[model samples]
Target: MSLGSRSSRRHHRALQHRAIALVVLASVLVACVFHNGASNGSPGSIPSDLEPGDVVHPSPIPGSTDQTIELARTKIKHIVFVIKENRTFDTLFGRFPGADGVTQGTTCDGKTVPLLRAPDRVGDQLHSFFDGITDINGGKMDCFAQGGYVQYLPQDIPHYWAYARRYTLADRFFSSIYGPTGIEHLWTFASQSDHFIDHERPGQFGSASREFCDDPLETALAFRSMARQEQERIYQAEDEGAQGLAQIRASLTSRWPCFDVKVLPDLLQQRGISWKDYRGENPFVQPLRMVRHVRFSSMYRNVVDVSEFMRDVKARKLPAVSWLTPSFKLSDHPPTSICAGENWFVTEMNGLMRSPYWSSTAVILTWDDFGGFYDHVPPPHVDLYGLGPRVPAIVISPWARSGFIDHDTMEFASVLRFIETIFDLPPLTSRDANTNDMLNAFDFTGRPRPPLLMRPRTCPAR
Candidate 1:
């Protein structure tokens, strides 16, 4: 009885052991598949050593890897992209007495031409509305002139030449795509109109039309994909490293999440890349609100309060990329007045450039979109955003040639491309991928651009 009972018990124990072994084997197989895919830089399920947003890829843009590594190495960082709200070229710089478009007339192929047309003589409807001479929209002053010989900068304005001289003004710059503040802001980053839904319907124009024009026309998206792949490759290395680490850790304390987590804060500390999404003060008119894709995702950091910027500045912490959007008071949405915005911006930038951070940084000053101000030069016909109207653009870098004017037509993608060139990072998606680069403004081979700092600016009151 003892021998028979003992044998039966041993058989039962053996079956249970086999079942446990099978379960462990299945788990290992699944983990291996995940690790392999993550190593290949596949999206969705990321690896242990990578951040959720991190992209892992094998081969990266040829120069991108080295550049990123170089950035990781230095405090002598590259771009400080400062983007402001809209103002048309004609409205802002055309009256600069020195602007060829203003005095000598913009020329092409040996012929002189006007850079922009004045708004159609403010239609009776608009002038009447603005003057409060007529009752419209319940006397709230719906003063916008949808048609007119728009107002031009008064010829007597001062400092127009100084602003141009101190900055790399792009007289022919164009908003990459059309529509309102939201769609154009996306162009600043992704350069893809993926969020746009409307295609060829004619009536939808401006911001509404653009928000609906979803298409990826930039190269940055491709790079993002590639960067993701490279990140995967790095994780593959890290995974291999983690396995070695885990085996070591397992031999000591019980395995916990802390030992396995690849924290972004830690990674950023190691890499020396600092990032923050500054939304300035106001939400109602903040460019971020207009970004359709952002609303659909948690991509944008909602509160980029001015207090944060002030705190960072006080701490003397100028990050590699300082993206600041002015608060509602600062954003150039109409009825708020344009002069106040320009004055505030010029003051803010002037102060920053004067700070110690100016030595190694290239501060980029640009308008987010043309504020529906009339620009004389028509944009080039491109199938991408489908010929958006012309907008003024300016690039002010410590490395930029002073008093320079670039007549080349530029788009928002051009800004990203400039960032890519200066920082040696790869481009993002869509039009940004194929768009013009801002390299023409600076000769990096030379001295950090000669100091061309100018006084705070203010556009004329409307």
Candidate 2:
């Protein structure tokens, strides 16, 4: 070819290269904007106004790094968070002395009804976000008549009551959200649910299927919209009642259950801290399975069966952070025998107490939701999502204050705060960032107390 023809081809190539460079620059600029906008106050960055259903990014609290580093040097090296299924604080400990519990409940129509004896296997009750709102009844707390007003006697849950007598019992702890199991589980790990409020829709995979991201069926989960929440506030201001709630519910949007949000494991992995999630039999209860990163990455290996927890404890191989969920039979969900649940809990405690990890481990025993049970105390409103009904929280650790009745207001985020503080990890969201770290429940300065192992009681014949 002639020199003139070669020069023409070279010019064309140069122009193509210039066009590609412009496109690359534009992509980089867009990415930077998205990162800065979505970062939840990352170091040296201001937080943007959070959108509804947006995944919260990490935010490091100024002046907290030093404090948390000192805490990580403490005797507690393991945190065993044992999460049980639904049962309200009042339902289990209402009549216990000195607790903020009531034996009677007021109906929506203004009649007072004494709490009935809850059966060993209570019937299932509706406890959706809507049900919680209706039961709260604009803070009057008298709408539980629509749900069930039942309480467990001391004889029924003697071991739990005994535990309260021996260890710190938090009377004011609430669920993270006003929804059911799946969302609450999400809060347990991430302190936020990516704005999803309820569980996956039933019947698509099966009524029992709680699988979110990893399910082959690819089910959609309902999430609240910030626009709808603002509208709800307006409706409340206008004194619109049931109709407004219905409108809000009708306006809800849905997305595939899978999410890309940051969770505690992300921080743990980054810091080289070991952790494990010992999941129960029911697939619906596993929260990490719904997180796309954990489910699909090498981190998935850390998700093990419930039995592995006991085995690990016996082998003295407990991780720095452990989450233990119960099987459906031992979940204490309504229609399941509470006796069996209690027995299972006691057995786990016994195993831990006998193991060497007990001294270094702080076990936080808590229920997931209220299960539509009557709780006289109205949950303090925190945000658009919740501070749902009160649930029982027992802090069982060698360093936990003995016989202490802690009334400090806390929720699932409080537990996250405790873990974050102990591990010197940054807060994943504003919820955990603002909540107290539960230092009030423990006395790390004093000598560690001896374990009080109790015998498993027999279930009464029904």
Candidate 3:
């Protein structure tokens, strides 16, 4: 071969070796990135103290050797919270003459009285329909009495006691506010009871003594507070325009950090977590759904579209937490009719829980307010503030002890606190910052929980 031809062949071989080396190096770098990301947790997974597959034994809280995560630890990955409409604990569970008797009561002299004995007007049309009767003050029969009635209202009676008795109940659950749906709903999720107070009056958000009404004025005031006080100044830019309506628009706009993302991004972003706002029909702006939708993270018009949710769960694509609001027609709120809204909600949840994903899912059922329903117990007073009215709250999970009853007084912040505890995320300001953590529900001791209650369908009493 000629000398020049030999040199050309050597140069070609060198180029070929360089190309091969580059390909191998790129492959190794890609593998390292993928492994590291997986070890930390893929996007939207619950932020846990331990990595995947790492066994976490019970770890006790500092200064208290007996208090450990194991004491209440149960395998719960997805925490689904469904907050329903108004109704008090006594209004729903008061009539049942069984274990639910825990909810029976009458307000007398700053005390609560249980209606153990049947009323004298037994067999009355309304009397026979319900297990309990409301006795008017002095047993009067006036429909509009001032001091409050001792008798029961048929609509307010929670007739699902027989079925619900099988599941756990939180008797001490209280509304964050006492008045209309909006204020209570706001507190239900945000734990902000003072935001709706008539700015004209100090220390009184709204009056629970009167029927519910929403003035555009009130909405404007509330939005203003959110703008000025939200942790992120994104809600408060005067640059959006106008003092009233324009300001409200700007607040809702994505300019505000809170409104920037479909779900809370600042806290979850660090973990590659993202949330989808599936609220349909724009429930927040709709007059009918505003109160309820504002309290939830997702507001879908068709709740029965379980397939959409099912797909995520089956694919293990479920976010660490999902907030679902019932369709307007499905919610038990007035104007919307479900014979047993609570039962319907539970039935829907049970379906999700029954899926193979049950091992890692938890569902919390609660009410937005006591709706005009009667509640016998006087809510506890804390620093001169009563935590609204008594309402029902249930926690369901494969890790929950079946038939467990939690009597501790709780607020919406308890739910937030639980989520924070689960993910070890920082608490959002407002009510969540000062709330008690619901760590008592899990069993960190390493024992598995009994199966959750699963009724096939909604059952209504004849």
Q: Relative to the true structure, how large is the alpha-carbon lDDT of every model?
A: 0.45, 0.76, 0.43
After superposition, the stretches of candidate 1 with alpha carbons farther than 4 Å from their true spots are 1-76, 96-148, 151-161, 197-272, 284-303, 449-462
TM-score of 2: 0.83
Q: Judged by lDDT, which candidate is best?
A: 2
Q: Per-candidate TM vs. native?
A: 0.55, 0.83, 0.55
The TM-score leader among the candidates is 2
- Per-residue CA lDDT of candidate 3, range 178-297, in tens? 334444444444444333321221112223221122332223222233422331232122111122224333433111111111122235555655432223221321222223333243
Residue pair clashes in candidate 2: 210-284
lDDT ranking, best first: 2, 1, 3
Off by over 4 Å in 3: 1-67, 70-74, 95-167, 197-266, 274-307, 335-340, 382-386, 444-447, 450-462
Model 1's alpha-carbon lDDT is: 0.45
Stretches > 4 Å off in candidate 2: 1-72, 145-147, 202-208, 224-243
Candidate 2 lDDT, 56-135, residue by residue in tens = 44443333455544753577899989898788998999998867788989887899998999989998888777667777
Error of 3 at 277 (Å): 5.1
